[model samples]
Target: MSQQDARIDAYIRKSASFAQPVLEHMRALVHKACPEVEETIKWGMPYFTYKGQLFCCFAAFKAHCSFIFWKGALMDDPDNIFQQRGENGMGQLGKITSLKDLPSDRTFIKYLKAAATLSTSDLPPATKKAAPVKKALEVPDWLLSAIKKNKKAWATFDAFSYSNKKEYVDWIVSAKTDATRDSRLADALTWMAEGKIRNWKYVK
Candidate 1:
């Protein structure tokens, strides 16, 4: 039998009433699949290891719990089980709010065994290639002039990351009509001058 951690006991105990059963069930399933799996605390969550390699992990969040294979990104998920939602949405397994959100125990065991097997074997050789480098964003003259008018906004825009700056540029450039472009430009400048990103509303 795998050694269970006391910390995980407290973690499950402290979890929301709705999440305790889910966490306990996942821990049982992982042990069933790998009896020798060792338990430890990682990143402030419960993680399991087999032969010193990460086996799997589970975390309870404000609304959901995450139980994911450590080698998931490299695994072949034929069932398309990994469904990412937003920047952080319980990794590839989607939000595991309940047992219905996950596959059957046999399916999970299959994934775990495959990951354990892969850990003990060398992966297939791959042809390595360098990733393409992205170029700096080109700010339009009119937009630049508009931004320059607001000293604080110009400083903020210049200091913004490439993706952040690109959001404003893409919004203005993608406008279908000149009138629409002018309107978006005005809105973009107003938001930028206020030291806010284009997607500020979406940020937590």
Candidate 2:
């Protein structure tokens, strides 16, 4: 193993455990496959690096461990091993509780090696581009009047971030009819008067 791999092993051995053996075994398998792979902690989880780029990571949760391929959405998984996570390019091979739950040693090693090769070739995974930041719009006179009439609404709207402010304004402005806009304005004002965002009650 490289110095980085040794350091990662030491770190894991010293850390608290939920699925210690599973993580360690997976780490060992990764190192065995790509001896040049460097290890580091990212987002408070163990991540592997090769050619100065992220290759993979593993995290242990309450009941399962996830092996995350940074570019999992791009890899060819003929065995259907990878599980896509929503619209994101990220994926995981889930429910990894122990060595037994993993692919065979050889298959696992092959995948790791393939990942390293792909990294070295500088082929990045296809991922959804982040949406551009939306700017906040000026508060309409009608909306402003509603806020002014409700002191609590004015204060709540003033406290909102630009994005949150824009969300409320956009919702009202997007209404097709004057009646619809007026109705939405009333509801929005009521919520704001309660010191809440558009969907504050539903937010976690």
Candidate 3:
């Protein structure tokens, strides 16, 4: 038997009048297609899990709703119901504003069963994203000389992390005009002397 969550009922009730029916219909299909599916909230939205793996989830926005399969990229989408990559909604069915926006009941249930099976199968692991490469920071000769003239600023800058130092160097180098560069460099030095980072105003 599938476990039904009361919060999901409340969630549907709280959704906009247009979205409530769409969400309720989607939820029912998920349960009907997978009798063993477990219901819970993840990331502030309703999710259906199977065999301790994420099967699918749905979200209700102000004007629309979306149903997303966890292994969407691996799913066999012969019907092309899945949205194109990088579209407005990352959901498989795109922005579902009404019941008509969804596929037929039979097609939707088939998708849910396929998703449930994939969740318990030995699916390939998701690829990991590589960490961004940090570029080297080069201090300008004039800027370096100016900082060196102030002992307090020099000491503060010397102890800064690579990111903190890069912030100042990038700000000075990105100036469009020589006067702007000089002005920013002067401000950098004054701030450093007071033991402040380049974006000190935003720091808590």
Better of 2 and 3 by lDDT: 3
Candidate 3's residue-wise lDDT over 1-204, tens digit each? 477899888888999999999998999899899988889998889999987888889989988899888877678887778775321244878888999999999999998999899878887534446797866678878888889999999999989988999999899989999999889988999999999999999989
* Alpha-carbon local distance difference test for all models: 0.79, 0.77, 0.86
User: What's each prediction's TM-score?
Assistant: 0.60, 0.58, 0.64
Number of backbone-clashing residue pairs for each candidate, in the order shown: 1, 0, 0
User: Which 10 successive residues of model 3 have the least lDDT summed?
Assistant: 83-92
Better of 1 and 3 by lDDT: 3
Task: Please give the lDDT score at residue 88 for candidate 2.
Answer: 32
After best superposition, candidate 3 residue 192: deviation in angstroms?
Answer: 29
Tell me which residue pairs clash in candidate 3: none
RMSD of 3: 10.3
RMSD in angstroms between candidate 2 and the native structure over all alpha carbons: 7.9
Q: Identify the runs in model 1 with alpha carbons over 4 angstroms from their true place.
A: 85-89, 121-204
Reference-based lDDT, residue 109, model 3: 90
